[model samples]
Target: MPEFAISADPIFGTYALWVGTLLAIAGVILFVLGTLLKRDVSQVWLTYRGWLIMIPTLFGTVMLGRTASVLGVAALSVVSFKEFARATGLYKDWWHTCTVYLGIAGLAIATLLPDPTTGANGWHGLFRTMPVYVIALLMIIPVIRNKTDGQLQQVSLSIVGFAYMGWMFGHLGFLANSPHFHGYVAYLIFAVEINDIAAFTFGKAFGKHQLRSNVSPSKTVEGALGALAVAMALPWVLHFSFPHFGTTELILTGLIVGIGGQLGDLTLSFIKRDLGVKDMGQSIPGHGGFLDRVDSLIIVGPLFFHMDRWFHGI
Candidate 1:
């Protein structure tokens, strides 16, 4: 019950403790910095507010048990895809959007609902092949419409939306079945957020060379390296949460998150650039939308999940 121990107490190990302490520390820092800059503390607090809303929902469900955690991850997938569909104008295609909705729900069911292979757990073999089957369905559905106006575009968009959001995010939900899911899932979420803060902090302090001036101008080579280094070392601090993770596994997983996070950010930049939009949507005040905030976690989910699966046999 060490996993559930976090939700039970606010000061247990680094899980709840780190979350609450970090949230408090960041709020104070942002407030002071905002005062110094003559800015609205509430406006600055908006970013922290997002965390206030997300962390409990994320960690809370996980603490409730595997069913709740899987449902939580699946719910996030649907919402994230909804934002993607809206940004790309694919939501107007109701039938296509329905396909994505169904695909994601089906993926969630494949994980949560009873199955012959996994009994009460997710069936990994089906998840591995769901993309292919879903892709076929997307392509075939458009043909039934017999409309060539935006045939290829809509079909491709639907495929990308489902595959990226549903398949990749599904990996996160299935991690509930891992040996130490409490720690693995917690680290993935916590460290990825830390990675973002590190990148931004380092970028501001010592950033000179743009890592991707065209895609994400704010990112810098120095910031990326600094974030990577910090993320790689952070696992040691939380290693107690994941006692089975070897030193090498922890380091490699950290690198996976660091690099995958940057790629995830760039992937969204490409999307926004292609769509001729600034932010995906204004769902979270200053934080754009659910998709914007979670883009990094999306890629890292599958990468970390598969790596852990490979090394430890999920």
Candidate 2:
């Protein structure tokens, strides 16, 4: 199969076409609602506009082949970590922040390197163990600086930055090494984004009780369940994306995107609550930040990757 061209993968091309068509239809609907009903949808328009840019960029990157996709994901991890560092006051500590940056870079390189033992495309072993080396280095930073005061917080933040933002997010990049990368990468991303939309739409329509009042007051149990339902159903709906998957793999994929995706969002919410911030940053027009956009993938990526690997050894 051709790996470098978008037309090479029928699944990827068809999925992209469907997404673009849906977005166009959504735009028309939103325009009609605002024009005919005189309803205010400026915020929704902003979000729709963001998706217009993001979707194309994402599809374009994946179209460029494995190297481009891996590098693009790595760049995303870097920016996402930057947002986290800035929000958590870790950016002020150059040592910790820079080390985290290095760790993230290391992950990207690991994703691109050939396996030493098998001469395969990606160094899965090294990628899996990157966190260990990153954490050890984070722990030793204070020692090298000969400082004890505030070192605990610094080290902790550094470790979280590297492990969560770097390693966890890198799993998405590592997926590019798989032979079925075209379908796997596109489907996971599309599914996760749809899951977010489901949550918002459900919450607005039927939300009665808050899901986590302390962490995120806006989220609701109804919304979460609705999103989960959509996520669970998506695997079957998009079965063409992974024809090799059996019942077991399909169920696992559902759980990974449904439950794991929400858990990841909640994890970021907890961090934001403790940090006394609403959004990580205002990078994207309506998405809050890169971190906000990718929070779900932090958990979903690893879960999906391991599941796929367990079954397909990818």
* Cand. 1 TM to true fold: 0.91
Tens digits of lDDT, candidate 1, 1-314 = 22365544432345877778878898778877787776777766887787788877776687777778888888888888888899999989988889888888788777765557546456887777788878888888867887778878998999899988888878888888775787787788788888998999999999999998888888999999999998888878777767788878888887888899878888988888888888888888768888888888789999988888888877
lDDT of 2: 0.91
lDDT of each: 0.81, 0.91
Clashes (N, CA, C under 3 Å) per candidate? 0, 0
Question: lDDT value for candidate 1?
Answer: 0.81
lDDT of 2 by residue, 39-112 (tens): 99999989999999998999999998888888898899889989998998889999888888898889989999
Worst 10 residues of 2 by lDDT: 1-10
- Each prediction's RMSD over C-alphas, in Å, is 2.7, 1.7
User: If scored against the real structure, what TM-score would every candidate get?
Assistant: 0.91, 0.95
Q: Pairing residues by index, what is the TM-score of model 2?
A: 0.95
